[model samples]
Target: MLKAILIDDEHDCVELMVRELARNCPQVQVVGRTTSSEEGFRLIQVLQPDLVFLDIEMPRMNGFQLLEKLDTLPFSLIFVTAYNEFAVKAFRFSALDYLLKPIDVVDLQEAVRKAERQHRIDGRQLELLKTQLHSHHLAEKIAVPYQQGIIFLPVNEVIYAESDSNYTKLHATQNRQYLLTRTLREVQEVLEERGFLRVHRQYIINLEHIQKLVKGEGVYLQLSNGVSIPVARQQKDRLLQRFGWL
Candidate 1:
């Protein structure tokens, strides 16, 4: 059984999570629970849990602050919060698991299962998450799951993204490409605010890397890397509007 701890400011929330874990996740044994971040930090050190269900909005010390106090993180972390879109994107970029408020049992079980498989986080991944959250700006780098580990890639290095069935292929600077397990739509949602535009159903191109836009024969864009991406008819106007051409 995976020993787990629950940390949240709301006593009621903690209680509910405990019950849910007990009912749904028999593999996870609740070793400790705390309503205070400070207390939670102590519980983690004392209990030495295998997993931690952390709430972001807590008094005295929020989740990130509590994490900073730790010398090392040896447990799997699954954030539980009512965080906004920016925070969600941060979790995605860090390749971390998060359960949104009004928690879904299905997602909780999935998170637990993932934790059971790989129950520890990379320190750099945590730092990446902290940097993005603390900066309150678009992320500079993204942790992409590659092979058996994760690769931290600069956001600006991404020149374009191609749809590959359920997966997304990322083309970056230095003539490199990576296959991400996430779908094209998921990739778009995270990269759109970071200067990427879905010009076609199969592609999301970085606006900054567009070298030329050919008008003839079903309009297409040539990127700095010399890859020509076709622009969907529906997205043509939006793409043109981005360059003040419409």
Candidate 2:
């Protein structure tokens, strides 16, 4: 059984989480819960839980401040927040798992399963997350899970992404390539806002790296890296509009 602790400033939120955990996750044993970040910090030290469900907003200290006060985090962390869309994007870039307020059962179960598999995010990832959140600006680095660990890659360095069956291959600067476990669609969601355009069902190219666009029998995009990518008939109009050529 995974020993767990719940920390939220709202008493109702804590109670609801306790009830939900009891119903959906039988493997998790809630060792302690608190409505104060300071008290929660003490509870964590005393209980020494395997997992912690932490709320991001709290009076006096808040979640991030409380985390900074700690010397080392030995337990897995799952952030519970009611932050805006930009904050949610920040969480994604940092490769951290967050549960939105009024948690969904499916999401909760999935997060717990992941915690069971990988105990916690590495220290570097957590530091990256803190830097982005504290600065109130989305960082240019994106954390991608690699092997059994994670890699923080600069978004600007990525040249293009290609679909490879169930996985997506990221082609970057310096002739480097990474095969991600996520699908092309999943990768597109993260890269599209960062100047990447999905020109074909099989390819996403960085706008900054476009060398030329050949519109002939078959439309193809010439990238700065010297790789030619085909453009889907349906996506050509959108791609053209992106550059105001339409």
Error of 2 at 216 (Å): 5.2
Structural similarity to truth (TM-score) of each candidate: 0.86, 0.86
Model 1, span 1-246: residue lDDT tens: 999999999888899999999999999999999999999999999999999999988877999889989998989899998988898888888888899988999989988987887667888887888888888875689888766667889888999999999789999999998988678998888899898899999999999999988888788899999999999999978976788762
In model 2, which regions exceed 4 Å deviation?
162-169, 179-186, 214-217, 224-227, 244-246
lDDT of 2 by residue, 163-233 (tens): 99978888999998887766798678778888899988899999999998887889888988899999888
State residue 136's C-alpha deviation in candidate 1, in Å: 2.2
Q: Which pairs clash in model 2?
A: none
Q: Cα lDDT of all candidates, in order?
A: 0.89, 0.86
